[model samples]
Target: MQITPDTLATLNNGFNAAFLQGFNAIGSQGNQYQQVCMEVSSSHRLENYGWMKDLPGVREWIGPRLINNLEATGYQIVNKDWEHTLGIKRPDIEDDILGVFTLAVQQQGDIVGRHPNELVFAQTLLKGFTTTGFDGQYFFDTDHIGYDVNGAETSWSNAGGGSGSPWFLLDLSRTFMRPLVFQMRRAPEFTPLVSPSDPNVFHMNEFLYGVYARYAAGFGFHQLAYGSKQTLDAAAYAAARTALGTQYRPDGSALAVRGTHLVVGPGNEAAARRILLAERDAAGATNIWQGTAEPLIVPQLG
Candidate 1:
């Protein structure tokens, strides 16, 4: 993405607010939270992923992304930064100590408040716009979507090659999961402390907050063009064009998929511009998807 003033302005204005809310919901530990943590025993796993070996068509199911709870807390503090400033300060100055205590309370909120942001960003950085086959795919209904008819490792796809992307027809819109679901706790609220005589100390009550969110960031229901193949060339651009028409759910139904969002890494800025800003197609034909999709340049997508 461009680091120019205008580019940065666009990013600041159009950053992912949905994802942000999924990460941080302030004052929510009492009743609202972005996500929650669910314990998984060795037997209780996060998800099941289907894979097939090229060697002998050996199929197997593997573990998918796991959710864990992390603890974040605000610190307790009471400060007398200007205790000796009685003459240097006003006589009826209780707001200084109380004000510092109030600020400390805000810090406490930030401590646990930022974990969801950190976790979500890390996950996105790791798997945004991936092209592998269900490498980290998670599904609400493993029985339907995540499950495949590979004969359970005893079965294999004899259809020439493994399944590629969905081959959907036009106008039939496909339904997709809302991307992420964060389960969180509303533990309690923060309380402050103040002593009348000893106005030097500020304190915040102890509390905890966390989430167990599911992140599914695979590229559509199937893979199209990605990796080095996604240059701004004819084939690469065709893959994107194809996705507009070819996207779908697993049931062989058309999603009538129309994408207005464009996700690209910093490296793809030039290429992305070439594709998104084209007045015509590569052969000077009428651009079909042009002016419809807006680019969301993400450095983490690199």
Candidate 2:
């Protein structure tokens, strides 16, 4: 192939196609964040999430309807610009070694597709202990205050105190609401700067392939998740489940947050599998905790 106007356009289109192919493939298969996070489309640079914790329970209508003031303030998730770029030297294209660059661009797309997983697991989950949620407390804290159904102030916990490898138990039954929020202002877009007159191409003597998006991840409902740093064993797992199941709504009603998924890093994969999959325990006794929750082994958490 010769360096011509027509050929440059063709190359750009080809790379874009490759990127889309790679993106669609991994985006469907490799994404795990979607299973745990409630994806919210963002139309602005930031979104207020204070209303997320306004758990208003349905009440019996007698004479007049009770109005639960849901005017919450303060909690917000600000979208941030994220990008990835790949450079293809002119010499590589001239030598017809386009295969490597094509794969690289595809891998770039793979990265784009997996970006949410990184944000949710690597960044948000790992930082939950320190990060504040809508209630102005750590997402995984021992002193989360709320009003019970009886209009009494109550304090509940979603964290198990320990100093070991961290693991999580989450209630994924609520599709519209989740333990975490993935706010997307823009989906990743692939752009190729292959025009010969472009400054980057002219000065650097290389074509630039870039992927850009705007998004943010935040804690949604603390009651929907429980994080523990204790040892991953039957005792600890059972305790975590009890904590999640006993959560109460602000209206003082039972939240009924079941532990649907047990999330752990690679370090706890075997233990998690044993707790959720093994039919029998190491003592050769029936494992009562078997089939309790699906185990999710996230590499990012490792």
Candidate 3:
């Protein structure tokens, strides 16, 4: 193809089409982050998660309605820039070997499409033991503070203490909130720098293409997720579920969180499947825990 305006435009259009094709293909089928994290749009470089605290439940109407204020928790998620670039040597297009470059660009789109899974599962959830949530405590901690029925400061936990491969039990029943946040400042855009006059095109003798995106992942409500490094056995799974269900709100009421998904790494996929799918246990006893929660195996977690 000649390096004319029309040809450059045509090349970009074709590459963009391929990019979308690849993106849509994987975005719909391979994304697991949406199962655990809620996507929230960000208009600025950083978003303050100050409103994560629970509000007081409605009480009997007193002389004046109790005005509960949402105090800032100082938890924030900052959107970070991300990009994946692919350079096609000028000779490739001139030689009509553009098919390979098209696939390469499409692959870049696939990478962008799956990036949220990396941020949520690989980075955030995998490191949840050390990562702080909105409550200014590690997302999965034993001493998460809450209030009791008497308005007394009480401690609750979302972590099951054990020294083994980490697994998570997430309460995704809430529609408006989740245990994790996916903050998107900008959707991915695929752009090309193929103009003949462009310095990079002239000097590098290649056409540059890239996908740019701005996003970040952070912990949301700690009550919605429980992480256990304990060997993912029947006892551990049951314990985690019980802990999540017994969480209380700051207003000293039942938060009523329930574990809806069982997240595990490749290392524990077999055990997780046995626990959730098997109709009978290893002892030939009925699998009472069957269908408790759906099993999600995240490759990145391994």
What TM-score do all the candidates reach, one by one? 0.37, 0.96, 0.96
What tens digits encode model 3's per-residue C-alpha lDDT throughout 200-272?
A: 7889898889889999999988888889998999999999988888765656778788899899989999999
Q: Candidate 3, which segments miss by more than 4 Å at Cα? A: none
Query: Which of the predicted structures, 1 or 3, would earn the higher TM-score when compared with the native?
Result: 3
Model 2 residue 282 lDDT score: 93
Q: Mind giving the per-residue lDDT tens digits that candidate 2 earns over 1-302?
A: 68898888889898999898888888443789999999999999899976765565687889988887777758999999999999888878878889888898888888888888999999998899999888889999999885565757778788898988899999999999899999999999888888889888799999899999999998888888999999999999999998888766666777788999999999999999999999999999999999999999888988
User: Judged by lDDT, which candidate is best?
Assistant: 2
RMSD of each: 16.7, 1.5, 1.4
| Full candidate order by lDDT, most accurate first | 2, 3, 1
What clash pairs does model 2 have?
Answer: 147-250, 148-251, 148-252, 149-251, 149-252
True-structure Cα RMSD, model 1: 16.7
TM-score for candidate 2, please give it: 0.96
TM accuracy, model 3: 0.96
Query: How far is 269's C-alpha from truth in model 1 (Å)?
Result: 4.1
Q: Tell me how far the alpha carbon of residue 229 in candidate 1 is from the true structure, in angstroms, after superposition.
A: 8.1
